[model samples]
Target: MEVDDEIGSVESKVDGVGDRLCSVFSRSHWDSIKDSPHELWIVFVLKLLSSYSYFSFALVLTLFLSTEFQMSDVEAGWVYGLYGVFSTVFGVLCGWVVDWLGVKWSLFFGAILGTIARLLLCFCTAPRSAVIVLVTALPFAESLGIPVMTIAIKRYTHTSNRTFAFALYYSCMNIAALVAGPAVDASRALFSDGVTLPLTSIRLSALRVVLFTSAVSTFITVLVVFMGLREIEVNEDGEIMPYHPPSRQVGAWKATVRVLKEKSFWRLVLFTLLLMGVGLVFRHMDSTLPKFMLREFGGSDDAEGVPFGMVYAINPAMIIVLVPLVGMVLTRVDSYTMIVRGSFVAAASPFWVALGAHYWAVCMFVVTLSLGEAVYSPRVYDYTMQLAGRGSEGVYTSLASAPLFAVKLLTGGMSGWLLERFCPEHPPPERNAAALWSIVGATSMLSPILMVILQPVLHPKQSPNIIPPVLNSMHHLEDDNASEGHNSESSNTGESDAEYQTGFGNLERLRRQHSSSNSSSSSSS
Candidate 1:
């Protein structure tokens, strides 16, 4: 009875301490959150929905171009590459527009454009031209979604929790990608079998139905944004205050120039460039892989064996499991180290695809690739924002899209040329498959080497002593309290008044010097 009572008392004390700790931590986090301007929960949901439309289209398009159009590895590569190229170009322009016109118009326009692009794709018949035009438009339309969403996130969240916000954002993107694969497959199977559509005799291809469905989804997303998303004004404290209806503005060129001048901005640009190059290879794989399987692994008849589209699903499927694990690793490790290691994984992806003969091997290769992406993708964005600092979120995010565009241009041309060069005059399926995998593998390997060099340039080290002005204010309060105590003691003891005044003056001067130094360093570095 005595032992039981003692145990209960100890448990009660532990519970009390735990409760107090929880309250303190929760209050601190809440206070930090309250200081932020925008509502993160609402924005997170909107971004998830917006990403779904884009990912759905990409997944369906990859299978469509590879199977129905019979595009070779390089040919399919160009199709996907064009998407990045156009998106990157428009993303830069969109950044300027978002900074000037605000998030509302940017999102509105993006949705409208994305809807139109999908609609245009549904009408396309000629494979090459259709692929080119669709690729070109898809990026521009989708480009608006990320930069504006990022800006909205930055406007609302404090620096401490910004990484968490980006992680959530990226996870949403992967979720969309995960959903898109199976959804596209199901949608294709439905329409191609004449089960869902009105027409009985004419069974539309899966690609056509998927494209139409994606277009409708895009339109729906546009409607939602128009109805639900409101633009918030940023206050002097750098908090997003309240929603105000947007006003038309000319251009964000001046703001663009200011952002370009920052050292941190350039670092983000380099890092994203390297990261995007690594990611672009995978994007190309979505288009190229199905065709490679069909050509190399004997996936001719739909009823005879596993569908090539199903194989493409492996990466996203693995991502659902791997990302949280990667997140755990990120908690203990610096992002740059993860990125470097992830780059090697990315580099190895094309080789696995090239070497693998069986469906299972291809699936395994995809799993490896996805694992790397699961780590690298979220970290890249998180690191970029960390480097960007307070008000320059939009600019940094937009600039990050630039290298992707450059890669697209180079890859698009290279892909087309490689296909034409290796498999000239309607080459056999075996030769086409081999050539495609070889090119992809070579590029994938090259990407990591580039990233290794670029990583250090983009994320330079900063001194720990430099604190932001907001933090400095809190330090001043602590100093004031210390000084009060010292003066009270001096009064009691009748200490020298001149010495006390000198000490206070010196402390103030040191604080001012530190503040000035930080400002200069921030501007210069």
Candidate 2:
């Protein structure tokens, strides 16, 4: 638990800094979060470290494979595209592992895989590591760690703070995103040829240095997670709740069978599909775009890293800046409204690249795309959290990856092939821009349409607030004056808030409406 002590010490230092900076906000805002548990802070640290490694890996992947294996754009695409496949497949397996061993061990195992994969990249040669093997193994290792942290956040924070919890998670990820870009660019410049150590006289390329550093960082992350994380149960209102620890805990396979049978779960599947479709466009920027730029625009590997890292970093940087503002504004709107409108903005970004004629178009694409992503991405997670049941966040969250799986299977594999086919070697970037982007754009546009069509069938009259309306209403009852004021206006809110809010205590019915849960509901604190 040395890592736990280290993290705690770091948090104390940051707390002092954070408090002084936050003094600009009104005191009430601080009061709401002043007493947040230490466990949530731990989750934030994990999010930051995990995202740093993941982003750096994504940033350098195409270049690494190209430089090392002498693979073509098409070949690099498939190897890189394999991440989508590995992540989709491994994400599910990780959920089961979480069910068997719990969140901490699931995370540890995933990090171990990632550490080894990155370490392998250090010593890899065209013949030694083998293209096919690295493609599959690296993705498998990296994908496993993602779900555990998300599940932990879900477990640790209740309805009262989930919005902020996710915001904190996203913000930390963006800070990493901000750093990952610089890391990639620096690595490229620092070791474009190779670096030699004075004592050992070992030389390594910038690529290997970055790759090995990532491996060491990931290994340290595994240790941090092992020593620092402890499971905490939470109820819907952001209150710490008792652990269920059911004597006969259900397995992931059974959960899968039951989840598949539920009509509500099928609706959940539809939502996942739509998310994946949009994500395909978002992902192309990482997996395919870097290689595409080098082939079409004509630059050395290190040079491309400059603008390419900015492209990857910009999206999350905007996300970090916009998260609080988006949360403040969008929370007043309905989920259906935000989902529809946000997807509209996101789908338009890639087409801009298709229409433009410069290297900077990619930057524009990320800027426009991130605006929509900021609004919708967290909502998608919130909605999925709504769909999960007692002690099933791990499994339900696992289902979220199905969309990425679909992207990998369907779109990811095709991206490289299209680039290879449409943009020939030594051609201008514009040569393939319209033909390739139009197809990507057309596929992306379908997601918002699907979301709009599925809304009524899946979540008829669903509101923006994910907090079970009853729990929200019940909180008002604790205050006599507030309850009286609420009673006076209950009729005008449409459902006679009095009747519906009162009746919402029947947790079984709410589960039926939001998700199909067979187990007893965990009542809100």
Candidate 3:
């Protein structure tokens, strides 16, 4: 009878211990997630407004150069190409500046510059000189926008949640791209119809009206950043703390160089260069495809013939549908794999473009290109963070934008020259198709090739000190406290059960003793 009673007691104790452990584990897991710092909804709003304004400007700018300025495909290409080059150069500088000045200031400066550039476009009459100045100023001014926004999101978000944050960011950009198409198209149609002002004496071209609208949009973005956004502060001990002014003066150049020295950083830079090179092939599709359709596809050059404006609509539309889905998938898949797959799809876009016999075929190719973008776009920043490791998120994020700068410098002038040379003044269908295919095919292939080579280099290695020493010290202190608690519990457990029971009176009293012992054990454990 005594043996059976003791067995029952043992069983009850085991159950009790198991229940306690399970409760502890559940609490720990919940705490971990709850403590993670990601304001997903707020980040989403910022991304939406920023992307909307930026892409809206791009859509208007493209349409204005093509229609109002009466620029040829080659001339329009050069003008836009120059804008890209300037933006690229300014982007490199802005990446460093974002780290030094803080994201808010960087964003504010970029927005102001962008607004001014757009407003200037409204008043300028000489297309050549105006195009040159706007091209130069707009990109440089806009350079700060993306890098600053990226840094802000990174600083505020947690590692596990960052991929989703970026995905949301990319989605907003695509959404903007989608909205810009109809907006620009409508503006053009309205302006062409000569809609008179309600009270003003000024006559306006559709292009002027669009430029003014773009400037206003930029100003609104500036207001949002300044008024709606809050700065995130990092503690000197290298932990995320409440927003406070930084005391230590860190030079942007030093931070940039430190980032450059990391092997992973270069690997990511190479990957971005490849990705941008590939994406640039598609960027040109908006400017080049319309002209190709007009000259070679037997489309009328009149508003109806390969309406270039219509092609712009396809990418944005596809992006709106695809981006959210891609964001959810990013949580499960390896980002590098997504990038590789996207590159392969992009490389194949030219073949699709070449295969297009009808306008629908052209539209299909554009759709394919946008699909590739949907997959690739979200992963770019996620990969940059991985490459950044710990202290260099700002630098890596900025570097991701570098490819846009580099590709434009290397290919912009050449693309313009090539179109002028190979695409005839009045291109036949065959010649136009060939030129478009060649450009897309060559540029698209480069991204995949570079990505394959860089992938091995980009793989994450064990980082020795991603978290700062001070943060690590605090973690060790907590661990020590926990360890001491566990040690005390174990020491108490060594005491006789009879002695505990004799002193405590009942099972409930024994449980209180056990709980105290266990609390100490937990500290050690």
Question: Which model scores highest in lDDT?
Answer: 2
Model 3 root mean square deviation, Cα atoms: 14.1
Report the error of model 1 at residue 406, Å: 4.0
TM-score of 2: 0.79
Error at 194, model 1, angstroms = 4.9
Best by TM-score: 2
Residue 18, model 3, lDDT: 51
* lDDT-better candidate, 1 vs 2: 2
Q: Which should have the higher TM-score, number 1 or number 2?
A: 2
List TM-score per model, in order: 0.71, 0.79, 0.72
How would you encode candidate 1's per-residue C-alpha lDDT over 263-359 as one tens digit per residue?
A: 7677666666666557656666654454445545553423323465566667767776666545532332335545666777766776665654666
Model 1 bad stretches (over 4 Å): 1-39, 62-77, 126-137, 193-203, 233-240, 243-251, 299-305, 389-391, 413-429, 432-439, 454-456, 462-525
**Segments of candidate 2 deviating more than 4 angstroms:** 1-30, 127-137, 197-202, 236-248, 296-306, 403-406, 428-430, 462-525
Which digits, one per residue and each the tens of the lDDT, describe model 2 over residues 332-442? 344445566678778878878787646778778888899988867766666666666556666666665666664675565677677767665554543567778778878
